[model samples]
Target: MPSVLKTQPWNVHRLPAAEGKRFLVTGGNAGIGYFVAEQLAGTGATVVLGSRDAAKAEAAIASIRSRVPGAKVQHLRLDLADLASLKTSVDALGPDRLDAVVYNAGVALDHPPRRETKDGHELMFATNHLGHFALTGWLAPLLVATPGSRIITTGSFAAKSERLDFDDLQNTHDYRPKRTYGRSKLAQMLFSFELDRRLRAAGSTTLSVVVHPGGALDSLTPSRPQVRVRTTGERLRGLPLGLLVQGKEAGAWPAVRAVLDPDVRGGHLWGPRVFGLRGRPGLAPIWDHLADTTTAARLWAASCDLTGVAPTFTPV
Candidate 1:
């Protein structure tokens, strides 16, 4: 039987089929990242799954191949917490053009205390925001070459209560893990929106968009032996939470919309339709922080200074 939901607005299948297109998805080894790759690759896009783990990345490739028979998928060695790894991935994409890049990889929910990246920054800030800021800057040349190519930064509901802390970019003092994570996500939204503004000012054709997956849980994500193996506790909590929360497959829709929807304008946020949590994808209402251009510019300036990469986008 044909799926019933396709007729409804926000159906994942409604997105046009993609062929001869290439996409890069960071953190594609697991969770919503993996599902985003799967959905895009299933439509015949060459999906590069980027993660720090070679073995797990290969496993994700295998999973995509299995589920989407003839899926064009590949592995990209990427460590969100490291810059050398970004260099490696950039070299891999040398001269190869991409249709879009989804900055979906991030550290979330669990970690050691006061931990930092090899670059000597807070792990959450370094991994979630800094790494993507660097990656986007590095890829600006390639992104500009492709017509209508987009850079999609994943935002979070956590950003609602967060504010920029310029005095402490690393979040070293009074650092609560959850709040720190939230602030990093806030940084992402700020960066994407600011990027679109700069692209416009510079007359660049590369688009920048932000989408947030509300409360997507890895526990509800299915187990893939080499990629993501759910724990017994995750299985227990996942099944119950699955009732109220979305699995990774459902969680990926908003991002897919941002990538494939020609009508979607840059700088507008997209989220799940119902309460920004669990439901079909829809246009997200703007929050006060989202509209604050001053704050967005501040965060963008800080990112460039900290990452030490200046992106020069020549107008198309």
Candidate 2:
């Protein structure tokens, strides 16, 4: 059966066929990323789970295959926290052309005295923004070569209120875990818009779209056994919150839509419909800070310097 037509409501369960295409979902081992990978797999596309843990990746792949029988899925060892390893990760993606890449992996630090990676960069910022920035630069060539390719970034509602302190991008002088995490995500959203502008100027066919999961909770998500086991108590507790929050599966909607929707274009922000919180994915208004090109340009330059990956997009 063909996936539902493009109309009033976007249906997550009925995605259009994407045969022969390849998509990468970072942190696909669990949470929203897992559901994104699984749903894309059902479209007859090759879904590669970008994860740091081999065991977790295997479990996710198994779970996907079980759900999407004959699903084309595999694992790619990706440690986004390690910027130096991203280029190698891209090279290992093989000769198959990439159709899309969903930047969904993220690290959330609820409380902390602040942490840094081996590369001496803040952990959440490194994993959430810089790593993807570097990875995108590495993958730029492949994306440029593939017709109608897309780069989907997963931002967060938590980032809407945050703004970057260009002088203190890493929150070096003063750091609060949650706020810093939000800032990192804001960076991701800013990058997404800036990348779209660059791609357009270069006349590249690759589209860059940003999305937010919008209040997804594990307790509200469905169980995938090997991937995750939601307790009965958890489900009961989550039932009441469904009006305001959604499951990780539902949270995966916007990114998945951005990847496959023919109507979706670059510089667009997609999220849940109801209060931008819980419901089917739809076009969400871009936060004001996301449109500050000056900040985005500065962030891009800093990212290039930090990762040493300068992306030059030109028609391929």
Q: Residues 1-316, candidate 1: write the lDDT tens digits.
A: 1112232355687567889989999988788988899899877888998888888888888988888899999888888788657766787886877889999998865654878888888888988999998898778888888888899889988989988888876778887888889999999888888888899888887888888887678787777666677798987877877656777778898898888877677777888877788878778777888778998888888877878876668854
What's the lDDT for all of these models?
Answer: 0.82, 0.92
User: Which ten contiguous residues of candidate 2 have the minimum total lDDT?
Assistant: 1-10
Model 2 TM-score relative to the real fold: 0.97
Give a tens-digit lDDT track for model 2, residues 1-316. 0122243566888999999999999999989999999999999999999999999999999999999989999999999999889889999998779999999999998887889999999999999999999999989989988999999999987787898998899999878998999999999999999999999999999999999988999999999999899999999999999989899999999999999988888898888989999899888777778889999999999999998888878776
Candidate 2 global CA lDDT score: 0.92
In angstroms, the error of model 1 at 61 is 0.3
Clashing pairs in 1: none
Which runs of model 1 end up more than 4 angstroms from their true locations?
1-9, 109-112, 229-243
- Best-fitting candidate, measured by TM-score? 2
Point out the worst 10-residue segment of candidate 1 by lDDT: 1-10
